[model samples]
Target: MIELRSQQGETVDLICRRAYGRETAENLAAVLDLNRGLAALGPVLPTGTLVRLPDPPADPPRVAVVRLWD
Candidate 1:
């Protein structure tokens, strides 16, 4: 687990992206789970708010691309 102080006007998604290089539903849920009542703070977290980050996946899953025409 990693701890980070929230920046001014920073949202959860932004934080996750900065720390983990990507934001996904799973990560978001995990973060929220780690920090209870974080979501209740609203979209913009108060500056200096403490946040816990989960360990990033070793290999981020790849998404399959759908081709409209080939």
Candidate 2:
């Protein structure tokens, strides 16, 4: 688990992207679950608000790519 303070005009998505390099639905939900009442604060969190973030998944999901020209 990682805890970080919110910067001015920072949102959850931004935080997740900064911490984990990517923001996905799973991570967003996980972060919300970890920090209760965080969503109630609205989109832009107040500066200095404490947020708890879950650790990144050990193995990120892989997406299969399809070649348009083969």
Candidate 3:
């Protein structure tokens, strides 16, 4: 687990992106689930608020396979 303090006017999305390196919709939702109280606070997060970040997966990041053309 990682611990970080919230900066004034920072949003959870920004925090997640900075902390986890991936701010995808799924990741954002997962963060909200972990921080239930912040979910209710919306985009603006108070300064100096303590936030806990979940541990990153031990495995390497997953790669997506994209399809191009039709």
Candidate 4:
């Protein structure tokens, strides 16, 4: 659970893009769900408002290759 305070004129979408990289519908929805009641306030969250961010997505798995000879 990541916590951040909203600056003046900052929206959840903007914050999510800046902090978490991409702001897809799923990501935005997750953040909205975590924060709760934030969507009711409309765009541009109030300053000093505590916003909770959900856990970031895990890194993609990597494939490893073993060669018999160098």
Model 4, range 2-65, lDDT digits (tens) per residue?
A: 8888989999988887678767788798998887799998898889888888878788335599
Off by over 4 Å in 3: 60-70
What TM-score goes with each of the models?
Answer: 0.84, 0.84, 0.70, 0.77
Q: Per-residue lDDT of 1-70 in model 1, one digit per residue for the tens? A: 8899999999999999999888989999999999999999999999999999998888888889999999
Candidate 2 Cα deviation (angstroms), residue 1: 0.4
Worst 10 residues of 4 by lDDT: 54-63
Ranking by TM-score: 1, 2, 4, 3
Clashes of each: 0, 0, 0, 0
Instruction: Flag clash pairs in model 3.
Output: none
Winner by lDDT between candidate 4 and candidate 1: 1
Instruction: Tell me the whole-model lDDT of each prediction, alpha carbons only.
Output: 0.95, 0.95, 0.77, 0.84
lDDT of 2: 0.95
The window of 10 residues in a row where model 3 has the poorest summed lDDT is: 51-60
Q: List the residue pairs that clash in candidate 2.
A: none
Better model by lDDT: candidate 1 vs candidate 3: 1
| lDDT at position 6, candidate 1 | 96
Candidate 4 pairs with clashing backbones: none
Q: Pull out the clashing pairs in model 1.
A: none
**Is candidate 3 or 4 superior in lDDT?**
4
Task: Please write out the lDDT profile of model 3 over residues 1-70, one tens digit for every residue.
Answer: 7778888888887888788776777767776767778766667888887777777668747889888976
